[model samples]
Target: MAPTKKKAEKKGKIQEFCRKYLTVDFVKSLIFSPDKLSFLTYFILFAELALNILIVVKVKYTEIDWIAYMQECEGFLNGTLDYSQLKGDTGPLVYPSFFLYIYSLLYFVTSRGSNVKLAQYIFIAIYLLQLWLVLRLYSKTRKIPPYVIILSVFTSYRVHSIYSLRLFNDPVAILFFYIALNLFMDRKWTVGSIMFSLAVGIKMNILLFAPAILMLYITSLGYINTIIQLSICAAVQLIIGAPFLMTYPVEYIKGSFDLGRIFEHKWTVNYRFLDREMFENRMFHLGLLVLHIILIIIVAKPCYLFFKNYARLRTLQAQFEPQIAAENREIEDLVRKKMRKATKKADEEEITPEQKKFMDSFEKGMKNQFGDKQQMPQTKEEEDPQKIEIHFDQCVQLALLPIFLINFIGVVCSRSLHYQFYIWYFHSLPYLSWFTEYHTSFKILILFSIEFCWNQYPSTNFSSILLHACHLILLFGIIRKIYKEIGLARQVIKKEN
Candidate 1:
């Protein structure tokens, strides 16, 4: 009896300790609470920056294309805009005039092209700016949570490599991309378009984002405004290209916009399974073209449908405002009464299965009909003025979907994928996570797979395919889920009417 009592006492103490320190609320308070989480965010950022600095100091020289960048910068400084004679491992200075002009400014600070420290410092500043812009964009939109910011800051090894080792123009391009996204979210459409144009100028790969941006502009602003904004964007690109066009028009055209340039099989990191001869086959290129066409259609169709349905829903809601409001009030009252009863029952004892079922049904109906009440515009005047209303999270999800799909498809059809290409998808991953409903272990597995593929010295064809395939599955799943939710919403609205 004495031994059993002691054993019981020990078990009770363990349970008490767990209740005090290991409860979900306790863990959530430690990590998910905004104030405590902000500290974690800062610590992660500081640690990443410090580690990157240390790596830069230790390596002292990068093995990638920094030398080529410096050569282009030197050529620009020497007033030799023609890059026909200047070639790098990736071929030539294939970037636009604005990139050359921007790189040339480094001449003012560093005399030697081999000054890796100076280059790293410049890139560190760019990285810090990118981080700040990301945080500001998320905070302003109120779309992503604090945990996402932490994930972005910590899981960005590819970005760190770009800044510290590769020293590519990608970071600069991404800086502009983030700034443009921020501006677009803030409704500074014209300036955002110009910034996006500049991003495309720095690296043509940034054009992957153009379709989505165009759709967003057209939907947010009317046709005339969108056209004007696009014209301004085109004007910015032309202005940046003008000097190069005049000096060496043929070379500028070939270098800046030549989409047909084929990389060698030896240089191909992602398509090794095709082997040397098969990598250069015309049939493969044709297949890629077909794949690109299919992907474009797939990505665009849903965007169009979503926009159309969203517009129709808004119009219908506005037309039946009185009826919708009455229904909403009735439902809200019913939900409150049910909630009160549930709370009273909970105070007395555990909720019955029937009560739980009713609560679940009530919540689902409420969500399908009106979304979260907090997300609905409070003022009737404000609600009526807007043609369409979308929750901030939904808005972000829609805006990023096209870009994510395009980048994924680009990777699928790409003949060559390098570690540096990870930039194309890295920024979108955290946002994509918001739409996914994977278990914690599954999410961790996905993260591990991505990191593993990226860390490979020369990415194997299988790993490349796997990484891209994983993203495709996730994106398609989210897209399907979104449309299904929209369908449910429509049904609920129709029923209410």
Candidate 2:
């Protein structure tokens, strides 16, 4: 009878365990925990796919740069290596050689770019690739809410049109940019650097992200590795431009990568408030360039401080490593001594039933708590949790914050921004918005107004001014958030006695 009762009890326990774990609700709960945001991200991505297809089917493909792109591709396909001779309807081939290679392929694919609808569909694929990269990038960070993604991808009428309708080369660079960012976040610094360089080869505008990217390399890979990565970037550009370089090096140099290229005041989205003369002034461009540098440097203060603090933390840890090890050893010795004494006492006496049960429970709890934690950390990331306040994930977040902020700085101080250029920073707006200390309404309103500015057929003075105001306010909010969240400069190293 006793045996039957024990067997029945064990069978009931097993049945309960199966019932709890194998249920539909349990599986749903498991899937929904932690990665709920990632699930939401994918759902939104599919919706974006439907939305893009609808846009392509319903909306007209407006010929903006597609004709010019095809013409440039025609010149290149005719075996023209000299960038000076690669003329489009818009202008000469000012973009790097890779642009030719990319557009040349497109040229062939869409019947020498005559199939506008087919090309629009391709752009839809390109736009989604970039967007998926952005969403995946956002997923790696823990704090950013999923709805912020809607603002980045969904809320933009102009961005949707820029991608599915106009088919600009900007989305290609933007795609590579996000790809490199995702790689960087994954700690594949070498491959990430290559992708980053490839992005820059597509468009010089991608250079706006360089300051943040370089600083990230410096912080993560150190100065020497960062210099090597810089060399890698230059090498990628040179290698891509090799044919043009061998032919008319001067023309390729001046025509492909001329930094002093003027922006047409007519397409300007951010500076209609300024006179045409002032907007296109070389000195004004220079001044904006200087201000851009200054602003990047200013916003980059937190990264510098983080690097400094990280160095100090390493130094302090080195000085205290011996002590930390000794303390750990003492702890291990004390635990062993206690364990030995308890075992010897139990062996010496006929232990009572309660005492034995209590000992077994205590032993199990101790092992559960401390057994896995006893091993010393071997990585440089966090040698001792007691000593190192920051963890690996925190370091990643710190690295990303400065990069996003620096790019925003560029957008704020840009000499001229066109409608298509909105894709450059639109995805980042949501990330930046959540970081700021503003109310949700203010952030949404600013974003809506910015969207309104970008969507306007001809950008007005009022829209441009409002765009700047929103940019400044958002910038201030993010800066304040960073200062509050990561006050590494003020972080003091406490020496344990």
| TM-scores, each model vs. reference | 0.73, 0.76
lDDT at residue 243 of model 1 (Cα atoms):
77
Residue 430's lDDT in candidate 2: 76
- lDDT tens per residue, model 1, 1-497: 24545797799999999988888886776554533443344565577678778878876555677767777677666777675854555557888777876777765566645566787888887877787766554443344556655665566666677788777788888888888987876667888888999998888878877777777777767799989998998899889988777788898888878888777666455666677777788788888889877877766766755554544544454577667567677767776777687667756875667887998898788788876763535664212221333333334445555555666666667766667777766766655655566664565566557767777666677876777767666766666766676688779999999
Q: Of the candidates shown, which would achieve the greatest lDDT relative to the real structure? A: 2
List runs of model 1 lying over 4 Å from the truth: 1-30, 33-44, 86-90, 140-152, 305-394
User: 396-419, model 2: which lDDT tens digit per residue?
Assistant: 445566777788888898889989
Residue 112 in model 2: lDDT: 91
Quality of model 2 by C-alpha lDDT: 0.78
The Cα local distance difference test for each model comes to 0.69, 0.78
Model 2: per-residue Cα lDDT at residue 465: 89
